[model samples]
Target: MKFLRTALGSAAVSHPAIDLQTSFTAAAQAAGLIKAGQQFDPFANENNFLLGAFIFEDVGVTAYKGAAPLITNKTYLEAAAGILAVEAYHAGTIRSALFTKGLATPANAISKARDSLDGPTDLDQSISRDGSMVNVTPTDANGIAFSRSPGQVLNVVYLTPKKATKGGFFPAGVNGDVKTSAGR
Candidate 1:
């Protein structure tokens, strides 16, 4: 997870939240997700690395979709655009690779969600009266035992510390009296 340690250069969302970084990291660790480390052999298992790549690519695609709206900074938006394109390429290549390996079924052949290359732009704080699925709803859906709303939230794994760039208590980043890099 060295790349993770470094690539998370800035504090995004605290873990347990469904943001791009945590989702990608968790997907990498999952069984059906990408296998980056050693001991990877395609013939070893029927599902093998091919499936992992597909899942990873799929995760990448949706991750950008999930994250794009939250990003307000122009620089971040530019980076996200690049990431979105890269994800598309990754998915295309992996889809072909999976087909060659006979792992992908015909039904699973390339299809996307309702939102396309462009994502949700206008984010409203409250729900709309039109009864649209895309309308927003804010509530702790977890409070109820059973619910049918998509308002389901992820666990609060970490908290956004006072500072964004430096290590702090919540990210489990560093142990120190001063919230910072040394001598700052």
Candidate 2:
């Protein structure tokens, strides 16, 4: 992120210091996805950790794809495309891991939860199987992955279906001009 910021001629100092676990837990609790006292421990359990990893990776790919047209610089657009490829690879790896563990149900539940936050449209997807064939890649009917706008991305991270300036993964909110989340 800092690399991209610098490449765009912006200072990387906008990246704020945050307690990820605490913010995640707070947002999850607020959204009623987890118990009040529970922490968002990525390694607390295999399926649980994989679910978290899959969500972020999937979102990263979509976010980059959605933002591509907004970027005017050819060099930066190329860089973002490369990053989107890497994020897609990460998402596929995590999806495969979830499928290998036979966690389709739980993974789908997480996907649904993300969908709820993002918008009324059910663009989010999960690992599934069609008899003998495993669906490792989440895509549309055309086999292309879906995209999410910056505001939609913020809605998920903020853990709210309503427009919000702060909550979820970022307790104090993000820096810069894009800080508001989209309403579901």
Candidate 3:
């Protein structure tokens, strides 16, 4: 975020920034993910918290990778690639931790939930092991990571398969033209 802010500040284009004061959507609150006044807890519990982290990191990696081809600026693309690498590393570490602690079932559940939100096609994978082989990286048969469109990504965050401008994480909606989530 700081990097983008700095880059934009140095450039001619002045894109509107994300609203930092945004609250969790009604759906999230009703689901008891967080209390009315409490902040989103990163350390809510051992398993649940790590599950959140796992989801976050994995999404970060895929989102970055998905956006790579759309980047026209070489410098920005390089920076994004660096960020993607870091996100991938973070995701791998989280997956390894979850596997070591035997949280594959819950992790897979979250993956399935995300998959359902994204689209009809099942692109998500389970964090599982085959005998002694641990499955850390979730990929296709060709070993390619899956990509989600902007709307698809929004669907997951918005917690809906229906087209929506607001719900789930962004109660007041995102602050740009691409605020709508795709209806699966």
Candidate 4:
């Protein structure tokens, strides 16, 4: 079979192995950002509601993109592509909350230091579980050209924090910035 997937982060190609996906989801829930049977309704109060969600979702999208090239199965590759879309949609929803007037995003309340991607240890910086880098292809204001590396993509997005400038968008943790159906 001819694999038409030539992109570094495409469904026909890049997709994290199932185990990684499960592990990541568990980590997210452990962070208490996700609740069982609860919708993604970010807090509109001057708290870091959307901010927390943004960090989770944005990191997730990039994580998949960073891990995509490492997968060798087409079926899993397609799933990753679908999941990435869902992650993006989640980000958008959180961003929209930022526009709710008087609302404060996590980035707004939490100090940049607390939100930093340095992880739990000051000994080193990490992009993935294995100390690898995160590569991400960031499209511009409009969908167009982009470039990414797994290490650069994920780490860079979370290493720094940013505030949003407009509505219907949440700042990507790294410059930070994903969708789907089936609760994907």
lDDT by residue (4-80, candidate 3, tens digit) is 65553554244433322232222234334446875544455776567767656777878887788977988788878
TM-score, every prediction: 0.38, 0.86, 0.78, 0.39
Looking at candidate 1, what is the lDDT of residue 178?
A: 26
To one decimal, what is the Cα RMSD in angstroms of model 4 from the true structure?
14.6
Tens-digit lDDT string for candidate 1 (1-184): 3433344456443342133344333333333234555343433555555543553454455556555666687777777667766776776566556555554441132111111111222111112232232111212345311111111000111122122322211344422232232110
* Model 1: pairs clashing at backbone N, Cα or C within 3 Å: none
Q: How many residue pairs clash in each candidate?
A: 0, 0, 0, 25
Cα-based RMSD of the predictions, in order? 14.5, 2.6, 4.4, 14.6
Model 2: lDDT to the true structure:
0.78
Top of the candidates by lDDT: 2
How many backbone clashes can be found in candidate 3?
Answer: 0
What is residue 91's positional error in candidate 3, in angstroms?
A: 0.8
In terms of TM-score, the best-performing candidate is 2
What value does the lDDT take at residue 81 in candidate 4? 73
Model 4 over residues 1-184: C-alpha lDDT tens digits?
1333444234343332223233333333434444554333334434345544544555566567656787688776787677777776775565455434333322332222323432332212112222222212234446522223343333333332222221112121212122110110
- Regions of candidate 1 where Cα sits further than 4 Å from its true position: 1-47, 106-184
| C-alpha local distance difference test of each model | 0.36, 0.78, 0.69, 0.39
Q: Name the lDDT of candidate 3.
A: 0.69
